[model samples]
Every structure is written in structure tokens, then in C-alpha cells.
Target: MARSTLLEVMGRHVQANHDTALQCWDGQNKEYIPVSYSLLSQRAFYFGERLVNTTKADQIQGQVIMIACHSPYATLVAFYGAISVGAIPMIFPMPLSLGSHEALTERIKHWGFAFGTPAMLVLEEGLNEKFHSEIPQDIEVIRLSDDPAASTETRSKSANDHQPKSDDIAFFQTTSSSTGDHKAVSISHSNIISNITGIRLAVDMADDERMASWLPLFHDMGLVGAVLFSFCNNYSLFITTPTQFVKRPSLWLKTMHEQQCTIATAPNFGFDYCSRLISEKDRDAMDLSHVKHLFIGAEPIRVSTIQSFLNKFSSCGIDAQVIRPAYGLAESTIITSISSHKKPSDFICVEADSIAIGESIRIVDTLAFSDADLSRYDPSKSVAVCTAGKAIDDMRIDIVDEDGNKIDAPGITGEIAIQGGSVAMGYVWGGEQLVEEFPDQYVRTGDIGVIHNDELYILERIKNIVIRNGENYLVSALEEQLAELLGISHEHIAVFESDIHDPSSDIVVLVERHAPIDEDQINQLLVAMPKEAFPINQILLSRAREIPRTTSGKKRHFYCRKLYQSGDMKFQQAIEVSPQRIMQAQALVNES
Candidate 1:
């Protein structure tokens, strides 16, 4: 059993399944349109060959190519085309609002200028006319619509015809949650192939297994794990937009059941959404008996959320053992550790007070631990669900103290560091000096976690934690506890420190309060909050609608932090307007 390059891996699949139906869409004509693998493969092959042959004309081999497209074919072409030509391909998440558009353009400028002009900008049909207007003078431009039958000749030969070393740089993807100037993580062919192989083995994916995924192609989970993994394994897959899942989560599951999806993975929040959206009527009409590997990842894994999902779906014949809690990041190419299929996994829950106080893990009985403290927690006693699970294949994980000494204990918590064949090359800015962070082989995840009997548990991002008055506060933990106490509904929340510009510093909690409450009620609640859990000096509440969130529904803390610092802050003040006040306001309106 010999492993092949990503390009060759996908090529073999495309060649074998040339006439197999691949893409399906409900068109405006109210009918299903299916595209075969041969169509998609040939389309990308033309563009891929053109990229290489044209690059030789300019003597550029590794210049970056950014693709902005919404069509399924365009996305496939953009990704495989870059891989075929040995150029660094990057994808930009579609900007929603005008605010996001401004932010994305600024990011492109920053990266483009930093990289000394891109090789070629690839735009899909409609965007070529609208967005291509501002292209930098030095960079070349190519449209996906330039030639529909472009790769007919190029599809004849395999990628083996053009030898690309395993170490050749394939592409770069920036952290989607990034703000201001974007930060990119570079991944090579070997990096992706290694991770994909490890992931395939971990999931026990057979050639006949099917995967259903709605995570965005720009996100690592969907791009490398779900999409690329399917291609590498020669498995069929069903993919749709994240917005489609958000609009109708039940549809995602319904389609999966209809397709008899055996393996599927999504962020934990997607499970939560499906749990909330699948009403009694919907549940009664649906059957999800075929879902085997229902993976939960990309965000904090809540035991309660998993339990809720299992409880709700168990009646629909969905097995409780199918709910697998996994952890991963882009630097590792979308898979770090996944739960074992040997048995149903258990979660780790500790006393909240101990964790808040930043104390070492002290395991009491589970029930006793829950009753002892409500705020702070010790990581060691946390439910096993919190563990990222054991390392796979050549991957090695270490929990190191601040002094770089490894802690060899189950209860010991420190920075999570990983070194493996699957680890990425590093971040790319410009020139060859781009990736220095992973100069050796290790990728410092910048995540805080603990190791318990060989299981890695992620506590939170070190950068997201706030330190004030000699106490470390996990803002997310505080938000979670508050949500439990207040009965708030949103899974996404962000807590950021706000400065008063006073000589005496004060910590302000900018919270997106889910429930409506008066300032007095909020203040009272804050005063009564568990001090040992997360100490707070002040409370600033906004409605849940006011919080800035990613398309994936993850809170954008950097945006919220900026909103607090800016004078544009608006608070949802609790006040009931009386009829008299309304009449007065009406009179004022009449006068105006």
C-alpha cells in the first residue's frame, strides 16, 4: 500500500470515477443539475496546465494565486489548479456586509503588498467584472470564464507527467477568525498528504464510505479534511454552503440520511443548531439512522450540548456512540486527535471554582466535584470529552511548562506543542524567510491544555485569556457559566478587556447578554456571581444581536473589543416606555 501525492491522489479518483455524478444543485429552473467528476476534473486540468505553461513565460514558479469564486466548479478548479502548477493557492471567505468587504480588501492589500504582488488573480464569472477593477498593476489577472473548455488537452496526462516533490509548497490558508491584517499558515503537499493519511486511518475511512459536510471550503475542516480527504480516499461526498446549514440544519441531516452518509464531521455548534432546529414535527418526519461518525470539533465541546443532541436524536435511531469529540487546528491540516470507535467516549468535568482560580487538577468524585464549586475549575478533573484524544500516527504532543520543560503527568497542564510529519511548513509573508515559527519541526499551537494519561485536553487559547489583578480569567468560561445561570441560548460568546484610559486601570466585561435585563438586575447578578469562578470589576451588556460573529457562528472577539474601545458603543438599556411616554414621543415626532 503506497501513499501518493495529493494531486495524484485526486487524479486517480477523478480518472476512476470520470463519469460518476459529483456535484448536484437545485437550479432556478426548479430541477436538480448534476455534474460528473470528469467535467470538474477536466475543467480544472485546463486551468492548472495554463497556470504552469503561462508561468514559464514569466519565470515564476511559486507565486501566490488568490481565488474568489462561489461556483462549485470554480472552487474545485482554484484548489486543484494551484496544486497542479506548484503555486501557492489561497481562498478568501466571501465578505457578507459592506463592513466585511472593506475588511477583506484591506487584508488582500496587506498580504499582496507584503508578498510583492500576486502571480495571478482568478475570478469567477460575475466577480470578474465587479471586483477585478482594482487589480494591482503588476499582477496578472485570469478569469474562470475565460475559456470554459480550457483544460480538455491538459486532462489527458496525469500529474505524474510533471514531477512535483513532496516538499513543494502547495498553498496557504489564513486563520479565518483572524482580524485586522490577516495572518496565513502555509501548507505543503507532504504536510496535507501526511495529515490526510493519518485522518483516514483514524476514521477508518473505506473507499465506499460517504461524507456529508457543509463547513466552508475556506475553513481547514472543510477544505483539507472533508473535501480533500474524500478525494484522496476516492469516496463520494455531499457538500453545501455553510449558509445552507444555518438556514436549514435539519435539511443537512435529512439529506445525509437520504444519502445514507456513514461518516460526517462538523463543528460542535452545528450539532447544537441541528438540535435546536429539529422541532417535534421535523423530528417525526426525519430519519438519521445512517450517521456513523458524527464528529464535534472546531470550538469548545460542551458535554451538555452532546448529551442534548444524543437525547434528542436517540429516538431517531441515532446512536449515542456516534457522537465523537475531536480537536484540530489549520496548522495540523484539520486533524489532530479523534475519539476512538472502540467505545462511547466520556467527558471530563471538574469543579468550576478550581478551574477559574487556575489551580491544578484535583479529582474528587464527579458529582462531588460538580457540587463543590460553581466557578473556577481544575483541568485535570474535567470531563473526558474535553480531552483532544491521543495522538495519531507520527504526531507527538507535549505539555510543557513556561520554562520549556515537559510535564510528565496526567494532571499537568501547560502549552500544547505538537511535532509530526503532518505539521505545516509555517506562515508565509514574502520571500523565503516567511516561515520561521516552525523552523525545526514543531508547531506551537498557542493553546493551553493539560495531558491526562496520554490524552490531550485543550482548555482555551492562551491569547484569549485575560490577566487582571493577579488572577487569570478564561473569558469564555465566564460566559459559559453566565449563560447557564441566565438561561441564555447562544453558543457563541466573546469576553474582552476594555480600558478606561484612566491612570488606575479597570477591567470591563463587554458581554453580549442573551436575555433582556435591567442594569440593576445585571449589576445584582454580577455582584452575586461566583468570585472564585471569574472575578469581574464591571459589567457592560449588549443584546445578542449586537455581537459580531463569523459566518461559522464563532464570535469575533477582536471586533467586539474594538467596538468597546470605539465611541460607537451602544448598550441595550432596559426600560419600559409607558403610554404617556409614547404619547409624548409621538407628539415630539409630530413636531419634528
Candidate 2:
């Protein structure tokens, strides 16, 4: 096998399809915006040349630079340009509110000072007029345009700079984590290329495939998987913001149906939301026959949720075989395991008790699942409706037990450890020290899983397990029971530990319910919930429409927990009126 650079691989596709439409989007004016492969390549080449000439990126091969832009075209160009010059691109998140703007700017200034250089800051064209004064004048800002011939006469300084080796760092992706958690995952060009190849093989994607996505570019799946993979593979892409999809889930299907998109991907919540929104009348009018791989990922896969969606949309041309469950993280570039097409299987459920307490997985007959002791035997299958698939071509995955020993059995559940060409070289900060954190060369994905009959099944996040009294409570287990009992939307339910005065531990459920519930309804819910499964001390209900979520609809649990702890969420309290009030008023009038 030839080991080619990312640019080398992508250039081949660009050369083959120079005039083909590669990326298309709707602009602010609702007009279709199109960019071709020839244009995209030229933009990347010139921008990279300009950076090498002015920024001396060859000398600072391991340094970090931030790119800030709203336009999809500019972001893509700047991303490829930074990688082309052997500098790591750090994508700064857009400030959510005006209040956060100054603090985020201060953070950027501190980071720039620490890096000891005015990092290259790319801005959207119109943003110059809006916040140009706020940006430091010392930092270089470049504007990427749709024209392939764009250039500045004063740009030539040192095109003679030496090129970088394949081992140099390419980018640092920032993920949401605790301060103690190392959130940034460093990736090299080789790692990214391997990931692209791995994903291409895992999904069995074709050259003519098209992918529609609404995930934010800063996120791993959107940046590496959706955009870069699409560009590298000569696939057409239709992308928009998460807010746009949330406002109208129908639009995702409508756009896909119109474009005949074959490879569509999203987190588990996205599918749940789409299933809820697509009205029977509207679904009847739409066409979804072209969708081949509707991927559910970025979170644990729930069997019931997927089955409900298939049952709801089976009449609307949605082939149940298209549902694919995958597992991956930023540390592994993007995709580690994806569902396969040839064998094809539906979502499977399993016992949650065995997962958390028994430390094993036993595939009980799916038919006998409902009648089994609901506490000991999971009503749903332990395995999800999908499989995480075999490791990609050059990658390797191992299920290991404690004491760092690899497990050989198919039913034993353990930590999922991955290694191979696509596994990131190491993280950005702490260098060798961070490399030491991982075992040998494998990145221990903080996820639990099992290998069954050569396929992998993910259980739950290792960090999310709650230690209550002497027993351990897996949050996902509690969440699953709550979803089935309360009829709460699976996408909106999150269970976390709360600090209450009770000696017995407390678990809080932040549910996204549309209608306000009275105390009686809540009490009934508590009564119906399995007592041994999840002992609820307090339950909080909030509407999903008002809840803050990522562009992918994953809940911001950290922030929501903070708000709840501070007594910020509003809950309705019923007040009683008595007839004795009228007698008291009459007595007071007589005395007057």
C-alpha cells in the first residue's frame, strides 16, 4: 500500500473532477451557493502559499493558530491551508452571546501570548466591518473568496521555504471537558488520511455518494468526517447549522431527498428529533428512497428509539436496513468503528444490570426479553440496534479488562482500546507526558464495550457511572428506564447525580417535556418507575425547545447541572384557595 500525504490524495480527486460541483450551500439570501473542485484546490494552494510566505509556518511546524469565520467556504479553505503548511489549526468557537465575546477574546489573547506569536486569525469578509477593532492588529487575517484566481501582489516573501515531513502535527481539536480533563486531541496529516480511508472502507462508500449534515464544523464528526472526507472522496455535500435543522427537521430529509443523498450521518438524538417532527402527511409527500446509510452515533445507541423511528417511517420509504450505529471519538481522528452493510442487522437490546454489576454480557433471546425479571434482565437488548463494526482497514480495537489485560472472550464487557495508523500521534499539550498517559500506543476510549462474534458493541461512557452508597449506577441505565416509563423523548432525557441532604444518594432527571406537569403527574411517574432500578429523590422537567443543546442536539449536561444546582430552573407549584377566606372578609367588613 502506498502511504500518500492528505494533500497528495485530495489533489488526485480535484484533478479528476476539476469542474464538478463539490460543495453547495444556501447563502443568507437563500440563493444556492456552489464551489467546484478546481476552485477549492486553487483557494487551498494560494492561501497555503501566502501563509508560508508571510507566517513562516514551516519554522513553527508544531505551533497553534486560530481560524475564526462564519462562511463555510472560508473555513474550508483556511483549514486545508493551515494543514498544507504544517501548522496546527485551532478552530475558535463562535461566542454564544454578546457577554461572552470579551471573555473569549481575553482567553484568545492569553493563548496567543502563551504560544509567543500573533497566531493567524482568519475572519469572514463582512465580520471585518463588525468587529475588526476588537481583533488585535498584530494578528494576520486573510479573506478567502469564491474566485480561484484571488491573489495579492505584495504576498510573495519566501515560497522557497522547505516543506514539512508527514509526522508533523496538523490540527488540535477542542472538545468539551472538565478542567482536569485534557480536552484537546492532536492529529497529524497521516492520522487524518488514515481516518478518511478507514471510514471509506467501514461505510463502504462509493465515489458518487453525497452526504448532508447540520453538525457544526468545530465538532469532530462535522469537520473531519463530513467536510474533509467529502472533499477527499469526490463526494457532494449539503450542510447547514444545527439551529436550522432544529427549526425544521423535515428540511434535512427534504434536502436529502432532493439531492438523492446516500450517506447521511448524525448523533442518536438527531434521528430521534427527525422521527418526532416528520408528520404523517408530510412524510407521505417526501421521498427518502436514496438514503443508504442513516448513521446514528456520537452517543449510546438505544434500540427502542431506533425501532420506534423505523415503525413510524416504514410506510414513508425509509428502509430499516439503512439504520447504522457507529462509535468513535476525536482522539481516533473521527471514525473507529461503523456499521457494515453486507450482513445487515436490526438494533439489539440487553440487560443493563449485567453491564454495570455483573461485568458481563449474555445475549438472552430477544423474544423472552419482555417477560424476564425487568430488574435483572434488560427488557431491551444489551447490544444496540446497530454494530460498531470491525475496526477500519489499518486500525485495531481490543476489549480489555482491568489490570491492563486484553480479554479474548466474545461475551466479556470491558474498556475499548484502539490502536493503528488512524490513532492520533498524541495530544497537543504536555507532549511526551501526554503520550505517556495512553498505554503504549493505544488510546483508551473512555467507553465500555464487548466483542461478540467479531463485532463490537458499546455499552456506556466509563466516566458517567455514578457511585451511590456502595452500588454503582450507570446513568444510561437509569436514563433508559426513565425514557420507557415517562414517555419522555430519548433525545431530551439526562440523568445525573445531585447533592442532596439524604443519606441515600439522589438522582436528578432533567426531562424535556413540552407540557407543564402538575405534582400529581410527577408523583405518578415516580410511582410507576422501577424502585430498584433508579431511586429518584427529585425529578425536574423542562421543555426541550427551550433547552440549550449542541449543534448535534447533544445536551450540555455540565451547564444544565450547574443551573439546576443554583436553583435556576422554574417549576410550577400548585396553590389551593379555601372558602374560609370569604367568611374572614365578611367579619372584617362588619367590624369596620
Candidate 3:
């Protein structure tokens, strides 16, 4: 807290641990490379000086700078370089799926539209043409060399010569499109520090703890939580690329085991992927006993995924309780609530229809509630909901109904709204805050959840629900039930509501299974589904692995619905062989 800003925090860590090192994967040599704090400082200094000179020539200070780099080292150097010289840095996603030149150009142009021309852009080669064509600012795109500071490069000036205040904007993190499309959340030096400090305390971090992370640096989890936090706390960090994890997730665990990492994290789907993808042979050889807290959050925490992963790896010394479920969003700087102690995650199962984000706080000041009141809020009686741990220090939660009325009773579904120090400055559009009708500080998370036993049980985002006949159904729960009934993995199914407000709007469920469903099974499932979950007016089947999802593995219900409404989507009917219903089904399937 004594440090004025992240610049000071980084400086202190470098000064104190000059010899301490970070271990990163070297893809070419298939070995981990050690990069010391002193070396990082020198590289940062070199990049910082380059930025300082550019901004000085442009006669602008505090110019927003964008950095899009694939290599973690290059990104760290570019980011620190920008901020060390008083320029704000924004780390952008380097889409690995950019397979074609047109795709790359469109992606860069899309980014340019969201971020009004930054004074300087630090990107890897071959991405500047599209950037320049779309942006109108007097922009200078700095190409990051493979090893910019590897040679005998001396800084012409001190790295932290330009000091920024605590209130200075540190960076802008893009919010995930759970509620909607992504938006930039301006995070301040103080905001980042507050979140890190709170998380450090919540998890009771120790000096000797080792951290390993593969999250993209563009996201707040990797930016503020993993990279910055590791440096600030002086913990030895083992970093890897997200692509590496996707290609062979076993590497994440293998590296963690080899380095004896104590702290690690992933979203729900990450765990599911690793559990399913990592072969039994690979799983048997790995050891995860060193991991103390595998914090799980970023999206809805799936109880089934956690349980299956634990069962699959427990023989390899991976403790079941180490799988901690957490809850937070970009608006709150990544982690607002996380499991802080050594306890098994409390899980509950409830009727999908009965579950609602109850009234922990429908209104902020109008209710008197305490942790002791959690005795009355028993999740086991209703549902595990999420039991997403408690709020971090100085943070408060409110669950309100659709009418804006407070819901104080447990198990009552409502939208989640929060107020805390970790909250971002505000939503930014075109480099300006949208304050027309939004709150000055507190963020309405748009996630629906209920508070029980002093923990958050997230149901789903308010926008993710399917409402028909005045009944709201959680699509995730329906998908889980349908997958079990189909004897297929949950990834094979996607359920959503189309034409949302129309009285005759269809409730469509899509499944991508290897085998087709017969007419009898289809009729039986449709009949039972309405009673167990909700009515599915239409069922569209696609080839396996064809469902679209966000980068974080969240099912893109809205996107899939859009694709289905347009015959342009690639998929065939599952019940196309049924002579009696093929015409009706095809008409509904191709209705869009």
C-alpha cells in the first residue's frame, strides 16, 4: 500500500530481487528460459526510453498506448515500458485464430474502432498496415523485435524517471461479453493495487509461494492478478502461453509439478478440458500435491466439472479441496470473491426452476445483514447455487429483483450489483466514460445470483436466461440435464431462446452428437423436458465441435441462435430421417 503506483511496486521488486527470476517456456528449444528481474528492468528501461522520446516529440504526455504482442516477455517489456514513462498501456488480444490476411486486417480494424487512435502502438510485425488504415491519430506503431533488449543495449535514461500518481490510470481491461459485447474498463493504479492486496490477503499468500499462470495477459486475471501480483509479492512466477495450455494442458500441470507451484487458477472449462484431454497415462505420472489453491472463477463454476476433475486426478496427489471456486468480473478488476481457506467447496442441487439469485441485499443501505445471518441462508437446503465464497475486503453485494425491489431472503433470484474499492473507474466508449444514467462508482454486474451462508451462488447472467410464459429458465442447467439424458458430454449441447420478446418465439436447443436421435427418443425427451426444465419448441443438431463459443469457453447462446435463424450456419437436421415430422422440423429449422 505504501507504493504510490504499480511502477513503484515493480521498481521495488526489481531492486529487492535483482537476482530472482521468472521461468517461461521456450517453444523452439523445448526448455524453460530464466529471465531475471534486473534483465526485465533493463528491457523495460529501453522500451520506456523509446516511448518517452516518442511522446516528447509528439508534445503529449499520458497518451494512451496499445500493446499487442504474442510473446509474454515482449508484452511485459512493452507494458512496463509505456507506464514507466507516464504513458497509459492497453494490452490487446493477439488472436491465435488469425489464419488469413483478411481476418487479421478486419480484427485489427475492429480493435481500432473501439480504441480511438493511441499515440503509440507496440505490436509484433505484420499487423501495422491494418492499424494505420483504420486509425486517424498521429499514430506510430513500434514493431517488437524477437529479442529487443538481448543485445548490448543500454538505456539512455532512467526507467522510472516519469513517476505517475496513485490515481493515474494504469491500464484498460476489456470486459467479457457475458452481459453483452466487450467494453473497456479503465483501471487505475490504486484500483489494481486494491484488488491485488485484497486477493493476497484473502488467500493468505506466503512469501515462499510459487505462482503459475497461462491466462492471456490481455485479460485482467493475467494482467493484474497473475503477472503484476507475482512481481509485487516477490513470488517466483512460472508463466506459459494460453496456446500451450490448449495444445497440451498437461504442460500446465507438468510445469507446475516440476516447479512446485503452490498457487494456480483456471476457468471451469479449462479444468474440464484438462480432465478430459489429459490421458490416464499422463495423469498418472503428474503430481499436484504442491498446489494449495487452484482458484476457479471467471465464469459460472460447474460443480460437475470440478467433481469429475478431482476424481480423475486424486490418485496423482491432487487434493479434492484444492479446487477452489471463485467469482468476479472485469468491472471489479478480476477477483472480487474467492475461497480463502482450506475447505471443500459447498455444493447443492436444486430444481432448475426453483433456483433464483435470492435477496442477499436487494437494496444496499435499507437492509441490516451480517455474516452471522448466513446461518439463516443455507444453500444445502436450496441449491449449491455457486457458493462462490465471500466478498473480498471492502466489497458489498446486492441482489435485486426485476422491479428494482430488494430481495433479502435467501434463495430469491435477483440481479447482482456490487460496490467496492476494486470497482473500475467506469465504462469507457470511444475513450470517454458513459455517465448518462450509470452509477458513478458501483457496477451493476448483470449476473444473477443469490447469497447463502455468506457465499455467492451465481445462477447465470440475466441475459443468459430463457423466458417463456413468464417462466425464466437457466440455459446452463437445462444443457446439463439434456447432456446427461443424451449420454453425451455437456460440450455437445447448447440451449437458447430465440425472438426473445415474441409470444410465439421458439425455444431452440442444439446438440452436436455423433449419433442421431430417433423419433421416439425425440418425442419422449421433448415431453419430459418441459416438465423437468422448459419446453423446447425446436431442436437443431450440428456436427460435433461446430458450436461457437467465446474465447473463455462460455457458450455463445445469442450467437448460436443468430446462426440458426440464418440458414448460413453449417449444420444438418438430426431428425431428417423421420418422414412424418421432417417437413415441419425443416420449416422451423430454416425459418430464419
Q: How well is each residue in 118-202 modelled by candidate 2, as lDDT tens digits?
A: 5776665665355667767676666655332344332121133335455556677765311112246777677777888887887
The regions of model 2 sitting more than 4 angstroms off are 49-60, 97-110, 114-118, 127-164, 177-182, 366-386, 430-440, 464-592
The Cα local distance difference test for each model comes to: 0.62, 0.62, 0.66
lDDT by residue (441-554, candidate 3, tens digit) is: 576776777776667767655455564322335566667777877778878788776544132457777887545667556655554442324356666777767677767876
Who wins the TM-score comparison?
1
Error of 3 at 37 (Å): 1.9
lDDT of 1 by residue, 263-302 (tens): 7887766777788887878887767786778877776666
Model 1: which ten-residue window has the lowest total lDDT? 365-374
Model 2 RMSD vs true structure = 12.1
Better lDDT candidate (1, 3) = 3
Global CA lDDT of candidate 1, please? 0.62
Model 1 stretches astray by more than 4 angstroms: 1-3, 15-21, 27-34, 52-57, 97-99, 128-130, 145-154, 158-161, 356-359, 364-385, 464-592
Clashing pairs in 2: 347-385, 348-384, 348-385, 349-380, 349-381, 349-382, 350-380, 350-381, 350-382
Model 3: runs farther than 4 Å from truth?
55-57, 97-104, 110-118, 125-138, 156-160, 177-182, 356-384, 403-405, 431-440, 463-592
